[model samples]
Structures are given as C-alpha cells and as structure tokens.
Target: MVVGARRVTRLLDAVQLGMVVLVLVAPVAWMVLSAFKPRTEVAALPPRLVFTPTLENFAELFQRTDFLENTVNSLIVAGGSTALGLLLAFPAAFAMSWHRMTWPATATLFARMAPGTLFLLPWLMMFTALGLVGSHLALILTHAVITLPVAIWVLLPYFDALPREIIESAEIDGCRQHQTLLRVALPMVAPGVVVAAILCFVFSWNYFLFALVLSGFDSKTAIVASFNFIGEGVTNWGALMAAATVIALPPLILTLIIQRRLVGGLSAGAVKG
Candidate 1:
C-alpha cells in the first residue's frame, strides 16, 4: 500500500509539472504558429490547428517596413550598451568587493531602485541641449543605465567569493593593483563575466520605453518600431505578432547559446575563500 501511494504521488507530480509547462508554453507556441499563418487562418473561428505555413508574414515584415534598419539599430544599441555596462560594472564590482565599500555600491543600488521614468525628463532635456535627442548615442546612454546596474549586481557576489590569498600573493609577487585584478583575479571569475554579458544583452534588447522616447526614424530600434503596428484606425494583430516574433528572435538565440555561463557569472567573484 505504501509503495503504491508513493508511485501515485510521483505520477501526480509529473502531471502537475506537465500542466504548468503546457499552460506557460501554449500561448507562445500559438504566437509562433500565428507568425507563419495567413490572416484568414489566424482568426479562423475555431482556430486552425493545422495549415500550410507561409513565409508571407516574414516577407512582408522584411519588405514593407524598415525592419532591417530597426534591427540594426537594436543591435547597435544593445551591443554598445552591454559593452558600456560591462566596462563600468566590472570595475565597480571589483571596488565594492576589494574595499568592502558601501557608498559607491549604495549609490548604484539607489539608481536601480529608482523608477526608470524618474531620469527620463532630465535625460531628455540634457540630450535635447546636447542635440543628442532621438540619436543613437542618446538611446545607448539610457540603455546603459538599464544594463549597468544589473551587470554589477549580478557580478558582485562572484567578486566577493574570490580567495583573498590570491590577492595577497599577487601583491607579494610585485603585481600592481591593476595587474592583480587583470592577471591574478580575472581568470577565475570568467563565468560571472559571461553571465553579465548575457543579461546585459537581453535587457538592452527588450528595453522599450527609453528607446521609444529617444529614437528617431533612422535610429529607431526594433522595440520602438513595433509601436507602428498600433495605429488610429485599426491594430494589425498579425503584423504586430509578426514584428514581435522577429524582435524576440535575436535575444532568444543569444540566451540559448550563453545560458550555461549565466549561473557562473552570478556566483563568480562572490567570496574570498
């Protein structure tokens, strides 16, 4: 009787897990399906479970709009911002770890705690004065704020976890501060770097509000361009989904490739053992 009950419990747990997966995945699967289906098939009364897929939506998405340009803009913004975030964050993480300082880390933490829009007006006005409004530089600057804090926060633990003996040894070996960080410390915390990069890339890719407010036609990012699908007369659900599908692809592919490194980045540099 006890064995039978244990088997039933295991079966129930598996069923629950399967149900959760289906619930979460069903809509996304539907969206991928819709991105390929013709308009008529998309809204068919009962829903078409099966149909001949068409490339028309992708073809239209590519040909009708400046989607390729928007994609390029998104790539540049995301890539540049991620690079900026990593550059700024790595040092910040190291400083906080090395000195056990609170103020600098606290200031950065406060920036993350603040609502994103709080900085918008000031940033906009500054950009306007600098003639950076609606430019790639403006967008990159804002996106860097989004990516930087996340990277630092994610990397902090990894930095904290490093062995202090290594640092002492480097000092004993005639290494300068920068050389210690570069040669003695960095190699072991590589996982954290990879994780920070993946996260920075994903956040910058999906960040819409800043891009929406900051970008112009030539510099408009894909997230901002998807806004075009919402018009006064009617909303093109099919095309909107199509645009969304395309917009989501790059980050999805990137995350898949870099996922294994994410955990290491989160835990690297976390402690001095």
Candidate 2:
C-alpha cells in the first residue's frame, strides 16, 4: 500500500513539473522560432511547425534600426547599476545583520515594494531640472533604485547566517569596521553577492518604463527600442521577436554560465549550520 502511494505521488509530481515547463517554455520557444520565421508567417492562422528559418529578421533588426547600439546601452546601464548596488548594499547588509537593524531594512523594502510608477514623475522632473535627462548616467542612477533593494535583501540572509565568533575574532584581531567588512564578512558572503548581482543585472536589463521616458536616441535601451516594431497600422512581428530574442540572450547566457553557483547561493542561507 505504501509503495503504491509513493508511486502515485511521484506521478503527480511529474505531471505538475511537466505543466510548469510547458507554461514557461512554450512562449520562449515560440518567440525564438518566430524570430527566424518569415514576416508573413509570424501571425499566420495555424502556426507553421515546419518552415525554412531565415536570418532576415535578425538582419533587419541590426541593419534597419539602432538595436545593436541600444543593446550596448542596456549593457552599460545594467552593469553600472549592478556594481553600484553591490558597493552600497554589501556594507549596508553587513551592518544591518550585525546590529540587528530591522527598521532600515524595512524602509528599503518599502521603497522596493512601492509601485515603480510612483517615483517616475518625481525622477523625471528632478533629472530634467538637473539637465541630466536622456543620459546613460541618468538611466544607471535610476536603475540603482531597482538594483539596490534587491542586493540588500538577497545578501541580508547570508550576513545573518555568519557566526558571531568569526566576526568577534576579526575585531579582536584589530580589523576596523570597514576592514572587517571588506576583508572578512565580504569574503564569507561571496555566494550571496553573486546571486544578488545576477538578480540586479537581470532586473535592470529588463526594466523598460524608466528607459522609455528618460532615454535619448544615444542612450536608448534595447527593450525601449524594441517598441519601435509596433505602429498604428502595422506591427513588425518577426523583427520584434528577433529583437526580443537578442535582448533575452545576455541574461540567459549569464544565468546558464553561473547556474550551479546561483542554485548553491540561493540554497545556502535557507538553513543554519
């Protein structure tokens, strides 16, 4: 009876897993396939499962638009925001963990939890008044608001898991606060830092509204540029799909490269040792 029950549970789990995969993977698969499909076939009734793939959409994306340039812009903003978030968050998280400062962490969380649109108008006016509208610097700084809270929250658990004796020993060894953070606590939480950085980069890379409102021609992100495919009467579905596929590549590659580490980092703080 127990063996039969176990088999039923396993079968249920497999069914749930397959459903989840289908829901997530189907759209991505369709997008990638459509990126290579001819323009006429993209929205064809009853999609073509067997069709000759072509590079025309990709060529159109690169040659006809500033998508390549916009991709470079996205990279710059995402990388900048990730670095800035880590720099600020690492020490902040360590301090919060060490001192048991819950309020500050809560404040940061509140900022994150608030609708992003809430800050948009204020930021727009402030940047415009500072003559900073349409600059990559503006995008990076605004994106920091998105990345900072994520880094802080992700790293906080890792810092909380640190042994008190290790921190006390560092202090006893004459390491100052900054030195302790930089040399001791920082090294111990390296996995958490990696996870935080990956999340920050992914968030900033995909963020669109800020870039759409603030960016100039020179600083437009690929996500914002992809909107060009949509017009009043005609939507370039194939080209849009191509742009999306390209935009999704960097984060996908980065995640794939560090997948093992990412999984380890996420699970590391789940249980105290």
- Which candidate achieves the best lDDT against the true structure? 2
Give the per-residue lDDT of model 1 (tens digit) for 1-273.
999999999999999999999999998888888888887787787988889988788788889888889999999999999999999988888988889986876688788888878899899889989999878989888999988888887788788899888888889989998898888777878888887888898999999888877899889998878876665322545666788888878788878877666655446535432
Query: What is the Cα-based lDDT of residue 242 in candidate 1?
Result: 87
Candidate 2 lDDT score at position 264: 75
Candidate 2, number of clashes: 0
Question: Please, what is the whole-model Cα lDDT of each candidate in the order they appear?
Answer: 0.84, 0.90
- lDDT, candidate 2, equals 0.90
Candidate achieving the largest TM-score? 1
lDDT of 2 by residue, 4-120 (tens): 999999999999999999999999999999999998899998999789999999999899888889999999999999999999999999989889998987899788888878898
* TM-score of candidate 1 to 2 decimals: 0.90
> How do all models score by TM-score?
0.90, 0.87
